[model samples]
Target: MQPSTLDVTAERPTIASVVRSARPALGLYVLFQLLAFGVLWLLSWKAGVSPGRFVGAFDGNWYLSVAEHGYDQAVTVGPDGMPAENSLVFFPLTPALTALLGLFGLPLLPAALTVSLLAGCAAAWGLFLLGRDLAGPRVGILMAVLWSIGPGSAALHLAYSESLLVALVAWTLVAVARRQWPLAGVLAILTGLTRASGSALVAGVCVAAIVAIVRRQDGWRPWLGGSLAPLGLLGYLGYVAIRTGRPDGWFWLQGGWEMHFDFGRFTWIQTLEGLTSNESSWITVTALFVVLAVALQIWAWCTRLPLPWQVYNTLTVVIALCSSNYFQSRARFLLPAFVLTVPLALLLAKLPNRALAILLTTGALVGAWYGAFLMAIVHLNP
Candidate 1:
């Protein structure tokens, strides 16, 4: 039998329906943000730190500097006439957006805040769309609300690339599901430009496309979409190389920052032994968390879920864990950790309304607390 065209009147919910459907999730998301803000404020007060102190802290300074001044290879050199890894660390997208926003007379801090918030909202909307595609409209709203209230949401308030990246990835996945190959590829490429981990999306899409080709599924669209995923990432890396007169300049910079990926492979036993030491408690904890996340991905894969979604998520977790340069704070870097929510959403759908409400409330509290602590640390230290 021929597949019927999607009925818009049947699939698209009314505005009133969407709002009424989203109310519970929206309320919970707001509560999550408020709680996070309150907790962070309290922590800052106790630590004798001001909330403003956290505004443009950590890597935010680098991005702001890059926005004010375009790329200069000389900027990578420190007082010792040696290139500092952190100097070349700026990614193109964030600074470019900052510069664009500055045309309107907005300061860097405010611009960052505005862009991040908008990106975050866009991400939530994308997640909602993805959920609606994969599960149902109700689940879609739940997924969006959960994402908005998750620990990762804190990235929106920072000058980091997480919010923008999440928005791109979520929408890219949505496009993939709809078989909009070119759109998926375009978003995937943008995602690559957003962050290093974005390469995982490229890989995932490419794999999915290859699988489709091998199985003789719809051909041209998948191939085109998959092919475009790595272009933005590779193009930017090439630009960095040309500017630095070193083909591997980007890789070198990542290494200089001690983000080396080979430590686990080259010194496996020693790495494990070191991690067991008291001084390496943080490393041990991070390793454990990464392992747990990887395990979750494996479980998802084994469960025979949708092939494309499974591949996308599994690759993301693998890259986060096995990639050469590992950071302890990377525990939160698993922003794609929201993939776990797919299953969680399904489970919640089957639960009683009261139970689902309780679970969402608990998740919001945890997410808020995590976000607050992250902000405090980044601000106070950086």
Candidate 2:
């Protein structure tokens, strides 16, 4: 008899296969980032400013200030007896890491950009791994590329926390899929340290744990991990409570930054206004994407997204839309809700290779154009 083509004994994929699998998507993402960088640089050069000065120009500057001088140095009181601009509202890790990079003689914006670039790459890899585990390698590859070039993806490659937050969310979900409860919870805690949005991760873990308990799981790992996941968020709140001598002090800081919890009434108005008027191109773009995201959210539910992912995505959208200010920042805020890539990835996986390549290239061009618009027109560090 001829030797069997398939061995009875199977071997797991080699590390090389894993790396090669992620490379195309990551390479595509990086290519677009470079393209955007080139366009933004040319625009900046014409405007008599170095592109380096703009990486962290908006919130990037805020993080740099937080890194260089402690939050206390940033407290200027408004006429209404509140902080006019407060650094405490921002998370600490980005600023802290940027400060460390700055100590090595790099300028703060450059250091922050370095941190963002590295984190964004990790995020792409994590998205690939998570997508592969959820569907298949094809879906995973598409998911990573789609997310890296999605609307408002400029935020992912900028000096902002969204990149790192998505990186943490992706890996935590990967750990969850592997049933590595402790690792998932630990990453969730780190996610909390990265942003207020970390609450979505904690919610996902909690929902997953509750379901596990209801199903009579074998051990306490789920509960233990769930318990561990909220510490990073609570720890920061506790610190603020101590410093300000008020139980709601951390929340007050949010108000100082003009971010108030309003149950999303204001969000609908903002969306409707933009959808109805041509007052601001950015607002119109934001409204259109939010509509697309809502459709994706519906698709996720119809496709039965796992309970944990569902919980995370639902809570993220709720938290974001309920916030009272910074309507234009909606794009930046929603970019980290990376689970929305699922439907798009599924669709893209159905395309023939050549068509997929053309579609991806077109998406990259759209991303690069929007990145330029954000840099040159919106005057915001996406």
Candidate 3:
């Protein structure tokens, strides 16, 4: 006699089921990162370049110095004993981590590499958690893989804060989605301390909480989540105030670095003025892309997607546009602006597998190039 058919609907996936589903995809993601790293390394080697020499460029050196020596306001003074401005420019987190790594007997550069790589891996896991919550385990793993092997992968290899910031932002979103308000808030706060644009996370969380309250859907939990999100940001601001005798010490540092945020000013005009006639075609293309990114954010806002994602995307766009430095490369700065990715991801979810794979593969290639190029330029210039 034939056995009766088992009803699939009767069996819901447990935590174990979810993990089992995600494991293979997650493994593929790790393999992708390894492959990307190898490819980049080969490119550098083909150019007869040493990774150490390339890594020695730009903000990397300054960060290494900060790690070796704790921050000193006096360092802001020049040889003439006047405030040189650049002295007080660097943020504290990267260097602090470098110092911690020294306890393990690692040199500054190696420590930075190790930290960036670890942070990248952690970020992938966090992104997986985020995607898992919003979509399914399979999509989550795919998103993580895309992020790790994409153009942004180069940021993970450099001594920059991109990896750390990505990890913090991803985990913060994960915590928020899980309804762990305090953890979310704390992570958001740490993100703010990590980068100036990080305040966007706090604003997003607050807006989300407010929406929940307005709907009268579990007020206390959302309120608590919102309230806790800014603590890391506030703590850092407090430190700046105590140290520099101004609550807005960080803002002042930004201003000193010529990164003024003037919303009403003509961003396009300022960007054009900064470009030279002889600059590469890539520069002009990138400038136009930044302008388009700003426009996209405005369009997204008008279309009225989810309020939290809207707020997060809008704030990041505004910050990028109003930024005085590298306004032309706002696209690069806004790479971690993942709220914009939500709508895109939703759209991609409906596509055929072949189409989705093509789109993701192309994005990953571009992301890897951009991430590496950004690091290379910064290292060379700094």
Candidate 4:
């Protein structure tokens, strides 16, 4: 029987079909997350450490503190009468979601982990969409896999807020790519509320909006979305100003943690020291990651991806590298810059299936080892 041309045309794939085809990427994302999680748990147990403590330490503890007790009205003072670190430095959305889950009878730690798991999955889905739209379905799946096994992905399974921010940023970018301006703006607002990196997302949205406006496309929506984008971050900063009675209240509070943008001066100095001098293995490894991140960013730039991705990735790396935060935490700070993995994914997608499987397994195992090591052995924040 001969098929009519109209029938063939009607059978052409739709947008919904394309989206549904990304399920394997989402499935693989969940698989690697669980596998790495199990490996870390076993190693933690073998080392006489509690898995809960491993996942709930460092910034996780601060998030738990915020969940249990809301933010302090004012920053505390140290013994030297200096402003000390307080819950205000932590973003509110992660802990707020944790506390909301606690109301449903889930324990605090479990609730926090639940938020991470859900947000991580959401982030993976959005990553798949971005990669798929940018290149193809294979690139999309590979991007998800690369991100799952990327450095500092352990935080995706922990109580940290990186997953939440990544989820928002990914979907916001996806929205921008699809010209869903209002959705992009709403997600940008949420991203702003999630962390200081929200500024990067807002900047990306504004750039996309501005481009659309200049092109005379999408009319008032771009203006509306762009106008709404920064409000969440501004609102939070304004609230902090009211609380601290200073115009730079957010920046002032961040001083307690020694976190500020310094145009990469601190990073360059510390990285050079770690590479040239006697440093702990972890410190040397961190320095190597710093180098690798910069190289990857350069590679991503050469790919000449979309403007939103470029803006977001550049700002994210700049924020991570230029900050005076703990050097060991720089890799973790870059986890949200998933676009940097796109170049790697493109290269890896050319491999035959069996070879690709072996390489991916090896990468996942290394990621698992690093995750366990950081959580159980290293005393510093990841």
Local accuracy by lDDT, each model: 0.67, 0.78, 0.64, 0.84
Q: How many clashes would you count in candidate 1?
A: 5
TM-score of 3: 0.79
- Model 2, poorest ten-residue lDDT window? 1-10
Using alpha carbons, what is the TM-score of model 1? 0.83
lDDT-based ranking: 4, 2, 1, 3
Give every collision pair in model 1: 259-325, 260-324, 260-325, 261-324, 261-325
RMSD to the hidden true structure, all candidates: 4.5, 4.9, 6.4, 5.0
Q: Candidate 2: misplaced stretches above 4 Å?
A: 1-14, 42-49, 74-77, 103-105
**lDDT by residue (tens digit), candidate 4, 1-382:** 1111111112446878865887888788888888888888887888788777777778899999989988854577787765688778787889999999999999999999999998988888888877776667787889888888877788888899998999899889878877789998898888988998889899999998999999998889999889889998998888888888888988888888878889999899889988999467777777888999999999988885888888989999999999996987888888888988988988887889899889888888777777777777775667
Off by over 4 Å in 3: 1-48, 73-89, 138-142, 145-153, 215-219, 264-267, 270-279, 295-305, 327-329, 352-355, 374-382
Give a tens-digit lDDT track for model 1, residues 113-230: 7777677767777777667666676767777776666544555566767778788888887677666788999999888888877887787778767877887867798889988889
Off by over 4 Å in 1: 1-31, 73-82, 149-153, 215-219, 263-291, 323-326, 374-382
Error of 2 at 286 (Å): 1.7
Off by over 4 Å in 4: 1-19, 79-81
TM-score of each: 0.83, 0.90, 0.79, 0.93
Question: Which 10 consecutive positions of candidate 1 have the poorest summed lDDT?
Answer: 1-10
Q: Which candidate should be chosen as best, given TM-score against the real structure? A: 4
